[model samples]
Target chain A: MPRTRIPVVAGWFTEDTAEEGFRLLGTRCSGCRSVHFPREDDHCRNPGCPGGELEEVALSKRGTVWSCTDGRYRPPPPYVSDPAVPWVPYTLVAVELAAERMVVLGQAAPGVGVGDLPVGSVVEVVPGVLEEDPAADTVHTTWHWRPVAVEALS
Target chain B: MSGDVAVLGAGMHPWGKWGRSFVSYGRAAARAALDDAGIGWPEVGSVVGAQTVRGGYPGYVAGATFARALGWQGARVTSVYAACASGAQAINTARAQILAGMADVVLVVGADAAPKGFFAPAGGDRPDDPDWLRFRVLGATNPAYFGLYARRRMALYGDSPDDFALVKVKNAAAGALNAYARYRTPVTAEEVAASAVVADPLRLLDICATSDGAAALVLCGMDFARRRGVADPVRIRAVSTVTPTFPRTVLDLPDIGTDSAVAVEPSPESFRASIARSAYEEAGIGPEDLSLAEVYDLSTALELEWYEDIGLCGPGEGAKLVREGVTALGGRIPVNASGGLASFGEAVPAQAIAQVCELTWQLRGQAGDRQVPGARVGITANQGLFGHGSAVVAVR
Candidate 1:
């Protein structure tokens, strides 16, 4: 049987599904149309506009790579990795969403290293398992960015 | 420029893992500054301390802690925390008080006893804080951000690993000349290239380490300086503590995303550039007038970035400046002449004040070997967590 899937943080991304696909969630201010990732549900961050109600919005699934790097050493907590197991280096990607005109940071898909993508390469967000709590048979899910083919998202 | 304050004295407790309490370092630095100024504890009417979160309760109320350690003198007290920018805020606070006539002579101090290894956010499960969320969610350490910036520079400006290594080489050479620097030995380009990669494009030697250190300054109104029989003193001409404007496009530390520029146009000048610009504008001096600069070199590549931000060179021209030795000692604009965080690591609260101390020395021509010849004007630039801005323009 497949393990139960859980979002590491709720309301930050869409539930994984074949038809709709996984998309990182954000909020758009109705008044100024400003976009915010990690979901700013409280108020619009725009200084000029009178406070507007922030509504739930889905962020652009595809974006161009703004920059990328890898962490070689084990990061200090609250980053949770199985300390019992040897550390595995992970790639971090900052992607620029053209529609939103903002950049969002996420862990690159497994096997995606810094060498795999250039600064302006296009990438797509997808659902992935952040970690597995083997004792509980549950997997924490999160969004990951994967580089796409040159012609795919251009 | 109207209400200039005299840097009557400056001191530091060195930079290293001393295994002592932050209070001790703060008191020692305070005493050193007082001694250098030839002023007693009682003569100081006010004290402002930069906060060190790692130092526990006393660190939070650092002003009282240092005062109590020095014996209570009923001095007005203030404590400020701006992550790495803490010391600048403390100095600004003292300068404000002196200008307001709240105090004739004020003692400003910042010290920290940092934990070993990567600087982590305070422990908790709350997701509200961006600093905590970044580590918990993406495992993005400070070096990760540095790596992104370095890689971006490499892509944008055709900067090579050789250019990055040269920065360490230059700073290490300068640090070797300073007695207070933690890393006193010069580093070679080959050594930097040989170091293990902490974050891609940035080697272990490229990033600064967490250090335990303290720095203090004695600041007073210009009248007080002359009244105290000091003929000439280093005067703080401007303190730029401006915040980032809306639609901040660049990704900053402890943030998950950049502010969207959909509604408004982003500032043409990056936040870092604005920091130095504010100081230069206030001081009525531009980059051409700078004798030396002490910028936060959290990473080797970041130092080069600062060269452009401070307008010493045009954007993407920082590497050329480094390559041409224009930013090295005996050059036209010597940067990080006191060794910088590249040598001092990061004492958090203390580092910015330490930058000022180096400026005071260089401007006063007291800096023994690393002094810039005929140094007259200096600027120190720093940016801390949560949009804290810092820059100090000092003149002899």
Candidate 2:
């Protein structure tokens, strides 16, 4: 049986391949014009703002790398990784979105390591796998950061 | 200042991976503090406990637990939980009670029996929990954040892994002189280089471990101290428990992203710098007055960050201070004279209290081997999870 792909955490991103797709989702306050990632559905977090309705908005697709690192040891659960198999290190990136003026953390794309993404380098959000549960026949989908090629800038 | 509270006594149970209940450690430390103060537990007017979440329900109401364990005399009890800053918050509560005339003397105790290996969040599949989501979604462990900060320092300040190793070497030398430290043996930079990398740009030796430890203090008003024939005691001048301002630009632990700066411009000073600044303002002192310091060294790189944050040096000069031996013992300003978390792994709630214990001893001229000569004033800086900021200033 083929595994069904689903977001590890729902409503965090879109898997769409179109221009508008594969972007992380956040909430922007109508009154304050401030944005929040991980979707603050309640209200504006800005203390100075009186109050505002939070509207779901897609975050910037591309951002510059603020910092990046790799996890050499296996993180304990609920970060699911089979202990029977040797742990493979994964790169994590903190990208700075200029429009939102916020830094978001995510896993680097498969085959992308810390050496590839230097600080201030451009990276784009891409859909990727968080984990796979064979028993449940499920593929946990999440977001990955991939470094943009320099040639693409021209 | 009228807000001053005297530190009558300070004590601790040595930090290590000791397989013992946190209650036992807390009880022992409490007794030691009572003895140091030359006062019995029954005479205590109030008791404050720093909560340990891993210890079940009893840990939540730690004040009553310790009070009962010490044969409760019906002392007013309080418990505080603020992640790493629990101890400092507990101290703050006790000081408030003393200043309010509710209690002439207050006992502050913190203890923890941590699990082995990496510290994971509580179990459950709660989508709303940011800590859980970060781990499940990105597998970003605590070390990952440390690695990010270390890399940032390297990129921004031209710091190298060797500079990070120097922190461990200097701290380990101090730890050797501390009787309560777990890893007392001095570590060399060569050994640090050989250790496996737990996170990129940080070696195994760079990160702190989890341990079972306890610390306790007895605090009283100045009048009460003079009445007890102690004219001059180590006085806690300030306890800063400030929260972060809006649009927190720096990414902290257990958070996936920083607050948006679109609406409010980000503060020129980082949240950490503010934590120490608030304490200094409250104490009416500055970094120049510090004879010694004990900042949270969860990682070697973090210790350097704290140097800049606590005003021990200017921005991006942490590595230079270490290289010049300015932060080492016998230098301009000694830091982590008790060996820091590098020597004594994190006991969460107990660690911050232990920092104060070191300050108390240093200010009193009681720190034998690791003592800062002519130590008159000392400060401790630590930050808890969420937005809890903690810093304490003590003077002789």
Candidate 3:
């Protein structure tokens, strides 16, 4: 099999992209000026907010880590997890973005455990491997927000 | 509170996976309702169809499809798509047409030929879509969200796994007697525990399955019903289809994040509670006046949550009510008289219409075995993805 880096999905963000900036694309209403993330394909969802055409917008690259948890058990069929090996718990992070006004979810970057990150710490997005199927020669890569070192930043 | 409309006829194509097209199921159910109403197709003033995305491309617009299937009769057609809440929206559309004097008699139909397994959003590489993102990103299935709710309930109310299993036991027993239910076998708590875990804290039995089914109803103006010598037919008093207020707090399905309540105080009532409250206000009835209820029991735990949200019990007292057997048969106020989603599974568009069908049967005293005694007032509550609220209040 040819070697390749299989991305979960294209265009939302890219693997091998620089660490200085990483964020998902969303839409903001021009008329009502309300921001919506994971973008609205149609009109503004805010029913009371008059009329506004949704415009493509960029989201916050970094936010404060709000709370975190771990799914110790395996998920259902749609979620790809190997049964042969013992289940490994992955850390789940919830970050609060001030600009868009929503809590975004993402997996923690590699080597970052729930115990390593404190509440209200700053985290930025970085590409990480979600799952690997060695038998099938597939490595699913997704974007994860890492609690970057404070000293690493200016 | 507004001009009343009479439900002239209601019918179903049963609830099971027969592997037929949604159009076939919808057309058959519509024909059965028309036959029950003793009205010909051409005599029907208008038709509204609630759409099922499981219909593939044809689902994009269902009203026209059903109109063509029933033979083009040049009637006013309206198709509504709101995931699970489509059925209630269809009823609301029909009621609007009748109240407006646009159509004296209207037919509303919802049908689905569902696929097996967890329902997924449209296939695409669209990362911007949250529904697609959750599936593609974290592989979070619907049951995972259900599991979260079950876990949260345990944390908040000290609810045990048996409490969740009891919901299945109660609903399954009721489902056993429902000829329209997909699963006819009554379930045991042991069975629920033994069933494979679809999501943590929730086993296969604790969640509903996807099935193929259809339901249809014929509605007419109150004056028309009285003129037809039908003095006391079941009336749809209120149809609440509201969206979530600005800052939604709950973590809903297909969405990875939640609205930050830092900016504004969250509504005292969640989106689901607002649905029932609006219906009660419009119907001029209180929770104390309700005789029975049919809620969206997509998961057994979610059903308990609805008990509190719909005012069947006080906050966090849902488990207590279930333990006391107040929501069971011969209880104070039996819920899910038609066995709910626990029996019917998720048929999307058809489920909401099915809820009303259950209400109609109870109100008419036609539900022989599952009837709640003297069910003169009933309500159905359900919410669809992306803030589609659905509730209907029916009175005899």
Candidate 4:
């Protein structure tokens, strides 16, 4: 049987791979208009704002790299990685969304390394697999940041 | 000065992976503090214990645990948990009691028995927790954030790997002279460069380790000190525990995103700079008055960041300060004179109190070899997860 596809955390990002469909989800406050990544469903976090409804909003698909680094050593659990296989380092990037004026962190897409992304380089959100659990027959889905191609700029 | 609380005694169980229970280390540190104060445990009007999450149940009710370990005489007990800022919160609690006249003398204690590597969040499949989510989603370890900050500095201010290594070299030299430090050998820049990279832009030597350790302080009102026939003593003039204001733009630990600045204007001063600013405001002193400082150096690059955060120098000038040896021993304003977390590693609850302990010793001229000559004023600054700010200003 084929593996089931599920978000590592539900409602954080759309599984849609198309350019218009693939984007990280966040909540914007109706009262204060403050934006929160990871979707604050409870209430507006802005202290000054009188209580308001938080509505899910799709974050900007493209952003500039605020900073980037690679994890050389394996992080301890509950960060899932197979212990049997040799550890492959992953690049993590903090991307700045101009429209929202906020920074969001996500793993770089597979085959992407620190050498590829410089600070202020443009990147876009894409669907990626967080981990695959063979025993569970499930592929945990997550978002990955990929550098925007130079041709895409024009 | 009128709100000053006298620091009668300070003590620590030398930081290391001692393979001992947190209670034992806390008791030993408490006893040493009581002895230094020339008083018995029974005389302490109150006790405050910084919570250690790793020690299980006893770590939660640390105040009662330490008091019970010392054979409780029914002292007012309080336990505070603020991540890395636990120790400072414990001290602040003690100071509040003394200033409020609820207690004549208070004993503050913090201890921890940390695991060997990468500090992990509590286990379980809770998606509600941000700390757990960060690890589960991105595998963003503590050092990874340090690496991001280091790289940011490199990109923004042109700081180099060599500048980061020099921070370790200066701190290790001071740590070598102190008996309480875990790593007592002086380090060189070359040694730091040679160390394996745990996170890109940050090497193994650049980051701190986790260890078992404890620190304690005996505090009382200035009037109480005077009544006890001590005309003058080291005084804790300020204990700043300010939370970050709205629109926190900086990406701090355990968070996958920064607060949006679209609605609110980000504060001109970053959260870290605000931590020290609050302390300076309360203490009525500027950075110029500081003879020495003990800032949290979780990473060698972090030490440089702190130089600017604590107002030791202007923004983007931390690399210049270190390069010119301005923050080194016998320089304009020595930082981490007791070697910081670079030498002591991290004991979570115990670390912030340990910073204050260093300040007390320096203010009293009791620090043996690493003492800053004629040191009269010192500041300790640290930050905790979940919006806990920690800084203490001590003066003689």
The best candidate in terms of DockQ: 1
lDDT of candidate model 1 versus the reference: 0.92
* Ten residues in sequence with the least summed lDDT for candidate 1 chain B: B51-60
C-alpha local distance difference test of each model = 0.92, 0.92, 0.82, 0.92
- Over the true interface residues, superposed, what is the Cα RMSD of model 3? 4.4
lDDT (tens digit, per residue) of candidate 4 on B1-396:
779999888889999999989999999999988888887888999999999776368889999999999996999999999999999999999999998999999999999988999999987787898989999999999999999999999999999999999999999999998888999999999999999998889999999999889999999999988998878899999999999998988898989999998888998999999999999999999999999999999998989999999998888999999899988888888999999999999999999999999998898888898889999999999987888879999999
lDDT of 1 by residue, B59-139 (tens): 789899999999998999999988888899999999999999999999999998989989998877878889989998999
Where is model 4 more than 4 Å wrong at Cα?
A17-20
Angstrom error of the Cα, residue B302, model 2: value is 0.8
lDDT at position B110, candidate 4: 97
The model with the greater TM-score, 3 or 4, is 4
Q: What is the TM-score (0 to 1) of chain A in model 4?
A: 0.95
Model 1 chain A: lowest-lDDT 10 consecutive positions: A13-22
lDDT of 4 at B139: 98
Encode model 1's per-residue lDDT on A7-93: one tens digit a residue.
Answer: 888899988675237799899998999999979988788899766788999898899889999999999988889888999999999
lDDT per residue for candidate 3 within B1-396, as digits (tens), equals 456789889899988989888899999999988887778899898989998765266786778888899999999999998878999999999999999999989999998887777777776466666777786678666776776677667766888789999999999999998999999999999999999766556788989999989999999998998898899989999999988887776767777777645435668888899999999999999889988999998899999999998898888899998899999988998999899999999888888988998899899999989888899999999988877879999999
Q: Show the colliding residue pairs in model 3.
A: none
